[model samples]
Target: MELIEVADAVQLGVERMGVGPPVLLIGGLGMPSQIWELSGLTAALVDAGFSVIAYNTRGVAPSTATEPPYSVDKLASDAEHLLEACGITEALVVGYSLGCYTAQCLVRRRPDMVTGAVFLAGLQPSPIGALVGQMELDLIGRLGEIPAQVRVFEQLMTTLSPAMLQDPETVSIWRQLLADGDSLWSDRKGLHGQLAASFEWIMNEEPHPEHLAQISAPVLVLAFEHDVFFPPRTSRETAQQIPNSQFKQIDGAAHGGLFSNETNVVETIAQFCADQRHRLDGGGSRYASP
Candidate 1:
């Protein structure tokens, strides 16, 4: 992992691994690059010929957090700036949860910046989704750092499928990961800011269904079959709103199941990235045009 200073004036703790096509992995709330490292997705993608760029988002220091008045658009700008800093002209962006929000912002704000994008477990703006966001914000605000970390650990525990949890080995690894404590979360203020920023994005910054037409890149929206955080119905419907976007719901995955059910998630994305690379190299677009 290296700390790279981008044009935004913030130095992010970034991990650029392997040697092939660049794939930017944008993690969400309660997730940093370390969690990806633990999930083995990085190595999996690496072996599949992707040079993964995994980085800790704001608040996860060694990566500095931005000051107040945070918005998902600002975070999106940070991501694009990071790419320029790394000298990567274009890349395939893979985002989960809040990271997906940033990806959307990037594609809409700067279409030429990304070759393709895959959104996993993403939430769309809706009345019900708004209420859920409020509940989550209140819950996060009530907890301090350690408690917040524990809360996240418990939340993630629920993201896995029941059968996965039934396996003793799986439970053991998850339990051990949680037992490490505070390291799982970044600074308290950063954590709170991230939550607030996310809530704002989901509630307001998230475009209307019709607004999705502005995005010009090839898009793939992945929904966990049972992701309560972002329902499959909603994710699929959101995909439909984006002209010519692809939508796939993984059968056995939940909100956090992509990690526990790593095989499919990693494999699916790897194939998409490879195809996109091939299409771009051949001066042809495999994905349908907008």
Candidate 2:
């Protein structure tokens, strides 16, 4: 793990493993890069000859949280700065959930810096905004109550695919992590802030679909068949909005399955990246002309 400073002196913690085309992995809200650690997906990507960088988003562990208010645009800008700081001209961006929102904003703001993008279990505007709003309210209600907050979070985490919770190693790691009261309290504040920013972005920010035609990079939308957060239909519609984007829904997986079902997710991403490379080298545009 290396500590790099982003814009405004915010320290971003990143782990760079592997050695090939650069692939940036962004985690979802509340969770840090440790979530990816559990999946073994990073190691798999490294073995497949891709340099992978997984970082804690702002307000997460080892990253400095902004004062009270934060927005997706700010998070996107942080990503851009982090990339520049790392001397990455263009990279394959893979984002899940809230990270997907940040990835979209990054493409919207700086399309030239993105070679390709993969959104897994991404939330779209409209109904997703409603769901996020409810989550925000729930978080706010438990802000002052640490025990209640932890209890609620544990319950919510368990609601994910049983495979995730059933893994003895995974559950043990989670238990040890939760045993740190200071870490839990600090993370709770960050999580609440992230939730607030995400809700605001989903409800008030310009729709991402409007800029789909503007993205010049190849895009892949990956959805799980049983994702409780954002349904596969959302990913399908997102793919339709982006010209020539590929959409795939993996079976027997839930919203967090990208981490739980590591083999399939890694294989799918590897294949997609290979296909995009082939298209780029074949003198054919990967993204259809709008």
Candidate 3:
């Protein structure tokens, strides 16, 4: 793990693994790249023949601060530069939550640098999405702008299934992980700045539904059935907007379900990015967002 200087003030924290087709992973809000390894996703993707590149999203340590107007486009550019620094011109993208937003920005803003993508717990540019997302942000802030490790663990637990949270071992493991992760990216000021940028984008921006039609690359949208912030219905709507894109709503999860069921999620991603026909298989029936 090392920090790559993208510009004078824009050094990004990057972690690379495996030695095959490059796969860039962009994580969601408050998630450092460490979650990928902790969830076994890094190993799964590597075993499936992929060079996984996970980076700390802006506001996390080593990555420079978001100057002003922390737009999704800026995060996309940071991703592009991170890839370039690693000497990779193009790669498949896998994103979760806010990471999904960043992935969408990457494909639209720099299509030439992306091949295929998998967006999990994705958000649409709708009032509901914005509202839910805002609610999440507000809740987090109320918990404290720089949350305690236990608070982080508690917050994440709320977004997972009861079955997952019921396991004491699982809780202990993730609690330690939360503690470990805080050490890496717990710069409160930077985090607040990133959230500020996210707020701006959510309020001022509209969903780019038209851009979906123009995207030539294949895409797979994975939505958690119980995700309140970004529901499966929205992912279904997003998939329809993109020609030939696949959509699936897996059971046994909520917003943070992917990590809770890492094995299933990793396999889903591997198959999708590999162009397998069954990539779109094994999901719940759909429901429209209310």
Candidate 4:
């Protein structure tokens, strides 16, 4: 674990493992960087022979928080600075959920720093998601504050698939996880900022749908089979827009598939990175953003 100074003297909590080709892992809205480890993706990636870099987004614990109503572009800038600070010229960027918005903006703004990108369980716009974001914002404004337990329950219901919630054993495990609670759920300011960013991204404020065509790096749009937010249809549309992109869906998984199907997710990502490396080694040239 290391503290990386990005912009505005804000220090981001970053973790790195392995010493192979670099792979930057960005989590979803308010997602702790430790999820990479808890899901076993980081260790699996290390075994696959790739340097893995993961970090807590600003406003999360160990990382300084700024004002609320954060924008996706600002988040992307932080990621750019992190790469610069680490002296990594190029890497395979992977973003999940809200992090997908950040990755999109990063690739568009700084193509030279990205070898390829993976949008895991996200990148596609969701009308339902936009509505949900607005409701959350309104609830925050009207109620002042929501109970932490309520928030946790809300997340569990929305994040996991109906199938997962139905299984008694799975629900039992999730109950324990909910009991432990997440730092993001307790941080009012950070939670608000993340919600604002999520809303903005869903509304297409930062990297709008048209911006997808401008991306120059090879992209993999990985969608969970049961992801209600970024469904496979929307994900396919998102992939078609990218000049160089592929779309794949994991079976029997939802938005929370990163945790529910960690092994499969890791295998898919490892294969994508391996293929990208082969392409680069074969003198594949990426297109420049217009």
Candidate topping lDDT: 4
- In order of appearance, the predictions have TM-scores of 0.85, 0.82, 0.81, 0.91
**Residue range 72-109, candidate 3, lDDT tens digits:** 77778888878777877668899887788789888988
> Candidate 2's residue-wise lDDT over 1-290, tens digit each?
67789876688878877666677788887667877777776776777666777898887877887665578888898888887777776777888888988898898888877778888777454464466566555756766433545544553463356576678787666556555634632345566667776787767744466687777788888887766666787668767888757888877776667665533887787777766554333232222111
Clashing pairs in 3: none
Give the per-residue lDDT digits (tens) of candidate 4, residues 45-107: 778777788999988877777778888888999999988877777788999999998898888
lDDT by residue for model 1 (114-136), tens: 88898878846445456655775
Off by over 4 Å in 3: 66-69, 125-154, 165-186, 276-290
Q: Which of the predicted structures, 3 or 4, would earn the higher TM-score when compared with the native?
A: 4
Candidate structures ordered by lDDT, highest first: 4, 1, 3, 2
Cα RMSD (Å) per model?
4.7, 5.5, 7.9, 4.4
Which candidate gets the maximum TM-score versus the true structure?
4
lDDT of 3 at 200: 64
Model 4: per-residue Cα lDDT at residue 125: 62
lDDT for every model?
0.73, 0.71, 0.71, 0.80
Query: Considering summed lDDT, which 10 consecutive residues are worst modelled in model 3?
Result: 281-290
**Candidate 3, number of clashes:** 0
lDDT of 4: 0.80
